[model samples]
Target: MACLSRHRHHHHHHHHHRAWLTSPDPDMLHHRPLSAHHRPLPHDDALPPLLRTPHPPRLRHGRHRPHPRPQFDGPDPIWDAVRQEAKREVVQFNSLCASVASIAFLVFHFNCVQAEKEPILSSFLYASILAHDCLEQALVFVLANRLQNPTLLATQLLDIFSNVVLHHKPIQRSIRLDVQAFKDRDPACLSYCSALLYMKGFHALQVYRIAHALWHQGRKVLALALQSRVSEVFGVDIHPAAKIGEGILLDHGTGVVIGETAIVGNRVSLLHGVTLGGTGKEIGDRHPKVGEGALIGASATILGNITIGEGAMIAAGSLVLKDVPPHSIAAGIPAKVICGLQEHDPSLTMKHDATKDFFTHVATNFRDEMPNG
Candidate 1:
């Protein structure tokens, strides 16, 4: 027993040390408000003659214009997942304790009597369950990387376990550094974060993570099969071929769909009854393409070959039939650009700003239309 505990401690520290030595600090990357639903900006979803790709901030005259990032520190999602996993860990620990105690007591009291029969299987089963959770945690990391190939922070999980009932003993030196470099997105997007947490509550959402890891490991069929099971259990369908990114939450998640060819970026969120489906009989590249930081609202239907750009918001009950630009809000039966995704004034989110922008655009065009008035 002592030997096993000692081995576990050594294994933990080794991982931490290696990750730090190899990977750069994740904090160095710009941290943004990584929720699916951030406030909209001033723009329309439909293409404007002047519109271009919404690139990150550029070097102004050889000086770096910082990426539009969050102003403060935020809660880490990986740590949050760890906190969640830890609750399971505690239950496992209790089971382990109980089984061990029961077995010990039986042996002490009925020494040769029970020793002559079959050994206890309950403890072994419970111990396997506990081991399953640990395996789940490790497998989740692989899935995240599969969904989005980028610099993923490994430390947020370290902090979560640190505060929980179990810590991966002594801790790995590199993982500690990974935690130290961990940059969690701002929690101001908690509504989205909360939704993702809710999705995790579903039966084996972590299965996708494992499948994702498997796909990367050259086991495509097995990966898709696992995803198929995840869809059956969770009612949330994500295509293994579809490229996804970091910090995304599939909230409420029932009937949430992703097409076989859909592309999703980091920190995006999709709510219940959301569809990323096709419009025609077209086969290859027929589905919609969604950009980074985009939000697809509840029961919204986005059909055909379209680009819903970065930071765009598709309001609830809307039918998106065309391309929607970055930083715009598309709502209504056949959704058009009602407003941009980044709306500054709180009073303007509800139909008011769209009206104001409409008049503002009209007033600016009045001179070209009518010389008087």
Candidate 2:
């Protein structure tokens, strides 16, 4: 049976390939299974045209060359920050210096304006001449020192003292105040220039200021030398160690003597022949301390370590040995407080005369103090 009927059958196996590669539709690629070993590459059509296309090689001397890296020619950010900070600091410092200079200039200008208001300085030409005179006087002082020493010390004295008295802040302020005081307080003072030039009191005070500075700076010999010159020329013997305050008016300056330890307060007025001295040869703070705005008349002598109270008026030729109360009138030998002041600032008024009421009060007190005879 097997030899008579023999039949044969064949089974065919086909491998599946990606259909999208040959087909027109690319959407069919997603339906096909991917291989585990490889990922699907993005098609050139998925990217923008500019990025999809390859750049052509550059030709230099008929050879292909690649593009070069870009360079930066700008300043560094950190350096720029540092430079800006430095510039800011410089501006701040400059502004500070300018402010200081402006203040100093304004003060000087104010003083000049005050001077110009006076009759003597009303004319600009007169003011200029006065300025010239002041300069000449200053030069004379410098020249005198130079002739005496002929050394570096003498040569630099002018510059040194000028800087201290004129440019120095505190001293300059004191000087301005003094000039204003002279103009306001003295009837004879015509202008600032006159006070600066011809006023022996002012000259003596200024010389004393320089000497005071020299004394404190350990230049004792120079300080004493200046004191001697002041005594000789101005006839106002103010010891360098005397602590005199600003706005002092030493009227008629001659015979005005301030002791070594005397303390004269601000706005105090001293008429000619006023003496602030110690009793006998007493040492160590024996000199009087005159309070502010006190008026000491001509030939009035304040002795020992007495405190002449503020706004006290000591009559001319009075001898003050004890403390005088404030705002009171002290007159006569060994000076007694005769009456209370209706006006406190006798210094400002420059008043020295005794009123009729004052004389009556004094006589009444004298009669009462006298014993029965």
Best by lDDT: 2
lDDT by residue (1-373, candidate 1, tens digit) is: 0100000111121121111122323532233443432222122222121121122212213432222221213333333233333222232333233332312311012233343342343223222222222322333232332232122222322222222212222122222222222222222223221222233412233444444455666778866765675566568787766665544545566887777788876556666788888877788987788876677777988888799888787777679999998878877668889765454211112222333554456567876788665
How well does each candidate superpose onto the true structure, as a TM-score?
Answer: 0.48, 0.57
Report the lDDT of model 2 for residue 348.
77
| Residue-wise C-alpha lDDT for candidate 2, range 59-173, written one tens digit per residue | 2234322222112232222111222222222223232223322123111122434433442322222222211112322322332342234342432454445544543334434
Model 2 regions lying over 4 Å from their true place? 1-157, 354-373
| Clash count (model 2, backbone only) | 0
Error of 2 at 139 (Å): 9.6
lDDT of each: 0.45, 0.58
Q: How many clashes in each structure? A: 19, 0
Alpha-carbon deviation at 89 in model 2, angstroms = 48
